[model samples]
Target: MQSKIDPDMVDLNERHELLYTSSPIAALPIEILSLVFHEVQRTRRATGKPMIPHVEITLSHVCSHWRAVALSLPSMWCVFQHSYAPWYGPVRPTRERLAVYLERSGDHPFDLWIDFKTNEPAYQRLFFPLLEITLPHVHRFRVLHLLSNANHPLKEFVEQLASASAPLLETCAICPDYSHTSLTSLIANKADIFRSGVPSLKYLRMDETSMFGFLPPLDSVVHLRIETRRTVPSWIPNTAFDAILSLPNLETLSLSIELFELQAFPSRGSVPKEPIRANKLKHFRSAYVLINIYTLSHVVAPSLESITMNGVDLAGLDDRPSIPNHVAFPSLRIVAFIRAKGGSHGARHGPNLQKLMAGTQNVEELLFWGKTGIEENTEKTHCMLLGTDSAPSPWKKIKKATLNIPFSSPTEILLYHQFIAAKPNLEVLRVPPRCLELPTFLQGVPPHIDLRAIDESEPPLPLCWVPGPDWLDTEEDPFLFYCRVFE
Candidate 1:
């Protein structure tokens, strides 16, 4: 049987087919479309304004089919970070929007980031329901506690969260909290973490004080990061240090401590009676502490590959601590000591460079920083010269090194010229930043220096960031700004 079709209905069907096949948005995969939405939302947050000019949401209002697809796919509406601006309007509506987003995420594991910049405690209470709904699904959580007031609502949320059983929890990051007077106070207020069994937690980071108290016994955490403040805590307990060492699977440990507060717990028997050792541990970075060489010799696992000390004060060995000779690191490869101009008891490591290299024979990369006041005196500066009568360095295997020189005057340039000329095997040479402007520095240099062949190629010099506490304040790329000239 043949029936006559309406002309308007046939025309509408043809147009819908053309639109679906021709437009780029219709061609996009669901994942790619979700990423596009994420990028749009990210830009809105950075600019600190209310402007959702995307007209896609209005498309679902046209019919039930589009709304059903959008609602069924949880990823389409799971992100809500618009609560930063309080002046925009009431907080209840945003809270409701967040609850909707959480509900849409469903039972699938997901990464959750919550930044509580809003200073109002009353508005924070509104998020409790959202947290209750979303906590179970969080696999990775990053909470930035930027609230200025003493009474932080997020703190209460964390307390409640720690007590609740979260089977899917894996990673957590807690920034510098201004509310707690000390680490003990922070832990005492949040001791409920001890009761919480995060059997699946793998990575944990906290400021030094909270690290002592809140970290429960974890057998699976592979990476641990501890950041301490500039002012030393009154003291840290030995039991706390013991608890840290006891972690069975801790592989990479990064410790960021100020120069004045690098001492090990008790300065005696910090390691537990059980002889706790991390068989898998490899990398260690002490951001600003004058590293206790003895501690390096004893505490590190046998398979250590890289050790970096940045802006630490390495002074007279009289006060330097000792480690048991029984301990040994057989696989050490890269060792870096980055000292800047303002370091206390400056340039002491220069005198012991040979000893350091000899200890790590397999070293591939050795970095040293000598800029301004570090080498102002010729007697003190002579320590860097390889075969000088007073200073000798036998760091033969080093393939790459960096020297930071920050000077605008000619006298410093002439001094640095003399300083760099002394090392014959110096494959990598970093001219001071100020001197790079001069044509003579880069006159005939090739675009890229080839290290393997020593011909006309200049040594493959590269700029590196001197790791210190201040590095945290800037972008995550530690060496990007200093290496812009190379670009």
Candidate 2:
């Protein structure tokens, strides 16, 4: 081999050896490597990954140099996920694990998800000690998520949180018990958890609707979401309505309320007799939450860009003030109607849809998801989506149409097809795979437009009218596809 080696080959071998001797990441500065590690953890959290041993622990095991860097950076250990489930055999929250994170994190702020849920009843006794250890560091919490359900224990922890002050808490998500009979809200004594005031609080998400009473002064909140799954009467008090409209910095507001006691409530809330302009509010979402239009009418968001109304009931179509001049969205761009199941109640979601379309002239995207069934009430609903021959198209500005609705009847498909034909500016169409079964379906679609068959919940591939949807799904590794598409 030595005798056969050419001078050029020797030079090539030496270069290859030099390249293989050093790691690509080893050349990167410590700061850049830290950023990369942080990005990996962030992506995992964003994707709902609550893995074992923490991602920092895995990074520390890569090599001695990496271990040194990971241990040196307190931020690398600040996010502690002490979540436990029954599936992980023999893997539970241990004192040593908690101690390691607390000691390594040092004075750095914490992003904690304390989901110590276990099937065993005795686990309650084991978790309180852990919470007590964590309670002292409450002031350093930047983000906190506490998950507990109806059958699990919470009185002990809720009592502890009632007096705890989180000065640095900016985002908090509380998933309380889902059952109607159980304790629905975390605030039992109506005490604000953050006694020192959450001036830094910008985002709060609550699963139960009854948590409104214990909510602290939300003047500084930017994003507020209350997704109540209970079918009981969960009315938003006049005070709560006023609090929402008065938020000067509120950018997004999502509410999911039941329809049980909506009809009995008054049409308007007092005090805000005049329209309060929500200047900073850009997105408004309501799911089956029939707030008195007369009350919410006072909230005029001229800067609103997106609207998502699901199973909404705007009183009745014949009712007064369907589209009040005071409630107009000139800057609106996107509209989505979800779970529009048909019936008398299903039709009510349309009047607001009509009002929104009539009120705006710049709607650029429209999504109709989970739209099913047919009934007497759907007549107006069909008209609202299909448009009339006599009337001009108001959604001519719509560039993308996401059709997650099924066409069981030919008339329904025709209506949707007509809706598509009317929009000359429609450049992208996202339909379900079943739509391809019909040969004539989208046959008229111009080759210039990107037509994708994807699930309603998933986003369409961003290819320039070429690489099919299958290409996006070809790579077995999600990271490779993500990099190929996004990078």
Candidate 3:
């Protein structure tokens, strides 16, 4: 039985074939294809998943027209992917693919992220060729969680990268090399190169390396993150701190110090003698489980506008010293304190906090957590929490706040009252679950606060009572304590 094709459907099929066969590439506008490619690249980067499959690349490799269109746009070829790990060893096409992408990328600095945890030995071989391919063109580079044991090759590779002048490389993040290689020689060799000046470079982060020594004077760096852990103290020289402070562009600094296992910057050595003040810094976050008085001295900067201390003590105090009124955070706008242990001992509170608040005449937000570090000594803690006896604070400009203390007392309520009194312009107040139990929590607050009602004229003051960790799970279930603020 012969199946007869309908003439109408047959003509439609013939027309489609004609369109597909004759200049299909031209039919797809370059602008439309460019948008498609951009979207694909963004998806790949965001998912942090598998590489763009070989099949996809092969599709573009299928015909001359496809290849021509794909290769014409260099931006389409730039990739910061880990899928090509299979070609870790110095293989033939790996180098070629890298070169093709680099040429296609054409002058736009590229970020290449390589993950070595998948296959160590394979990556060892792959790393060399990749380095050969990337050392010349590195705009910014990051290597995450590389585990290089005794047998792997990392030191040599790092040396090559350090020597390569990446003037445009503004950011680099290399995680702790869990591998057992000593970093002394590595840092010693690269110190001068790093100092010689990469003007465009602004942010640099490294792990397992004590940068207190051998670093050249840093006049260009503004943001620096260095980690040192469980190592011989001899590796880091105090001179590194001095060199870092000499930087002219420093605006924001984040320090995470590991005291138990890692070596501290040399105390007896020559220190960085830059003015004790940070001139342009607007934000600072410190998270050191244990910071000494010397370290605190190194951190105090006159230009600090905001400070966030997570598991850190700002001013290292002695055995129950009076809270000083001289500790400075001048332009402070927002201050957040997060608990590492619980309580505030050998830390800033009471008068010291008042002084900090007074220094920040323009402060708009203030956050405090009762428990962190040691359990607050009852007598001293009461004095600090009670705050000073005064009229509505002229210094309190707090418009937004978050209190996550596990327990609340009369002192905490007093602080809240002070905030409401001081910030006449306060538009939003966020309180933790326990803090809402305070008797006068929303005493004078108005009813019917609506975000929609908030505008240039007829501005609204809205208060948000946030739930504690006990109520908030990964799934955002609304388990909140009842409040009659609106009523």
lDDT scores in order: 0.47, 0.60, 0.47
* Tens digits of lDDT, candidate 3, 202-252: 755544442422233245667665544334333344444434443567876
Best of the two (1, 3) by TM-score:
1
Looking at candidate 1, what is the lDDT of residue 353? 41
lDDT for each residue of candidate 1 in 1-487, tens digit (9 for 90 to 100): 8675455765664655555555667766766655665565455545533354222354344334445556666555544444345443665665666566667766544444444445666765665565565555544332221212233334545565555554555665444233334342222122345345566766665554444334443666666666653255434434444445446777666655432223333464334445445567776666543444424533646777766654222443355444343445667766655443243444434424435544655565554444313454433443442234334445445555554444455544444444444444455645444455665544433344322312213322222323223121211323222122211
List, residue by residue over 1-487, the lDDT tens digit for candidate 2. 4354354665664654444336586788889988988888776665554555557888887666778788999988887665555443333446557667878899999877666445666566666666667777888888876665544545565567765677788877665544444333232223355655677888776656336334554667788776553456444435545556558888887665542222224464344556667788887766553553532455678888877765434434455344354346678798766654334445444455555566677888887665433455454565566465655467888898876655666765676677677888889887767776666666656787788775524543221112122111111211112112100
Error of 2 at 266 (Å): 4.8
Model 3 regions more than 4 Å off:
1-26, 43-64, 83-100, 103-108, 117-126, 138-153, 176-197, 210-217, 227-239, 259-274, 289-302, 311-329, 341-355, 376-395, 407-425, 432-487
Model 3 / residue 229 / CA error / Å: 7.1
Candidate 2: Cα lDDT at 342: 38
Deviation of model 3 at 396, angstroms: 1.0
What is candidate 1's TM-score against the reference?
0.67
lDDT of 1 at 53: 28
Clashes (backbone N, CA, C under 3 Å), per candidate, total: 0, 0, 14
Best by lDDT: 2
